[model samples]
Target: MEPVSPDRVSDAPDDRFDQSVEALIFASDVPLRDEDVARAIGEVTGADTTLEDIVAAVERLNAAYRATGRAFRVEQWGGGYRLATIPEQAGVVRALFEQEAEKRLSRSLLETLAVIAYKQPVTKPEIEHVRGVGADYALRQLMERGFVDVVGRADAIGRPLLYGTTDRFLDQFGLGDLSDLPTPREVEEILADPRFSRERAQLLAEWAADNQPPPPPADSSEPVGTRLRVVVSSDSPPTPSEADDADG
Candidate 1:
């Protein structure tokens, strides 16, 4: 008799398990875990399958696809393996989605995000201290935008809610870690520009106008358009030559 064909011998239950794994990976929204693959295969095959077997099958599949230059491949993400299109194809996929579906943070929102990102596990009061203004509105905007999250509570009295940036934040900012933030001096230099500060203030005003509660009426008992301005510091002393010229 002719030697048994490898193809004939390969058409066994394990082969069927491999196919089921592929299907589950394709259907997952995010990367599926090893246990997920095994559980899915077991459910379909009516036989117990180990994650190790599933992992070996997935590895073979990924290697085959990679060797064949397939447009899609299996990848490990979020502690799970899943089939995903190659990264090069993502631009085309992104183009098909509605532009409005994309989220964007306003300047104040970005600044607030940066602050929380750098000082993560920080409280709202800490944020206000850095900004020198109430950040309640900005915090709400960040929360709505999905950039910042309430990680936990502070250990201090009153147990204020502590906020931190999310994985989405890392994805959006293209940063692998928070340590990439600029130093305090660098941040101060960036914010010291008159134009930059003015633009930032304008952006904050616009964000507040769009999201925050309406301002109190001018007829309210409290005076309106009458904020008391106090001189903080004098400019550098006039140059000696200029002072002498003025005196002359």
Candidate 2:
């Protein structure tokens, strides 16, 4: 009799192989490809697990999740199986992750990332030149977070490292590809809009004013009121009484 092929093996009635596949998928941080799952299971069980068997196991696991009303289900993405929260449970999942979102990249880091995303494969100097600020800290933070990576070295005199967004960046931003990123024209239009620009400027101005160093403590020799008068005078045209006092 001919030996049965691994592809012909059936994973029915919740067998050990099926359970192992489920556990692997659950434990994986990123998606697990069928071949990867099959190879891993074959090593542990010393059995010839095939891609077909791994796929069948995933199907069964998803069925079990659905039947048991589990909030998450395994789905194929980026050529592998990953557990994703079901649409019906998205609200609760988002609420749970909102706290984590609070710890997300700051505006400065985001600005630096946007520059790299749009201008890659670009260099750190290019990013800094566009943003008019040093990008060393933001680039380091992005690299630490796995959102950006050094793709290659530029062919310039100094041969600076070329940076680019990573797959994690696309996944984190819910983009299927870099092409899904917003176009430069779209961003330019948004910035050119008077309403949006005015609001942004106002918010920035308010934030700057709020964070300004408390008026350098009034000189010990000057009264607080006199210092306030000086500040007010500098900020606007002095009233006739103030002008006359100044002249006197």
Candidate 3:
């Protein structure tokens, strides 16, 4: 914030500045950068707004939101500021935009993503070596989902492309930056959770159920879920009295 000259030292400029910052952050679909806000407001107001000023204005706005019990507030993530719903409203937000089944990542994708997030700027071959599988499909899906991007090319024999997590990845996962990623040891602790293994078993069960062949269709037109009954006939012969009665 620059020192105001005597003519314009009233509360209107400060109020308008705060309002302008709020409008910019509200209008941006993605995270809004403080520098962008400062530049835009500076050009509009002829006031040299600094990043610190933008930050302070955001704080004031957030304090207002808290005071008013708003459902959302501005949050700093992925190197920029974005409006984020409060944690208590998370359930409603998720319900409004439920994740589709097709978007669900399989175990292989999770493993590959973890490897890339932890050892980013790494090559496909290195990822494969760690995961013991080809990374072509995983890399393709991650790139398609805007989670991973090619940072550079490795200086190996072929100069393979290097992959790293994108800012979208950080924003999607609620991470401020790569530093927010859990360490390998922490991941190990998560893997050791009994619930994780149980969920793995559940996935296997669902896969087995999906891949199993359908039962042979019944010729009879019995309704679905109805029990079937089988009656067996005796094949043994009768005694001599039954034979004589048959002859008579």
Which candidate tops lDDT? 3
* TM-scores, one per candidate: 0.49, 0.53, 0.65
Model 2 reaches what TM-score against the true structure?
A: 0.53
Better of 1 and 3 by TM-score: 3
Over the stretch 1-248, how does candidate 2's per-residue lDDT look in tens digits?
12223353455434677778888888998867788887887787678887777767777777767767888877766457778888887667778778545356699999999999999999988999998999999999999999999999999989999999998887677565688787766877777788895686676566655555556555565444532223422434567997799779
| Predicted structure with the largest TM-score when compared to the true one | 3
Stretches > 4 Å off in candidate 3: 1-13, 90-104, 184-248
Clashing pairs in 2: none
Query: TM-score of the candidate numbered 3?
Result: 0.65
RMSD in order of candidates: 12.2, 11.1, 15.4
- Whole-model lDDT, model 2: 0.77
Ranking by lDDT: 3, 2, 1
lDDT against true structure, model 3:
0.80
| Residue range 147-216, candidate 3, lDDT tens digits | 8999999888988999999999888877878888865667777899988877866765666555554564
- In order, the Cα lDDT scores of the candidates are 0.71, 0.77, 0.80
Error of 2 at 95 (Å): 11
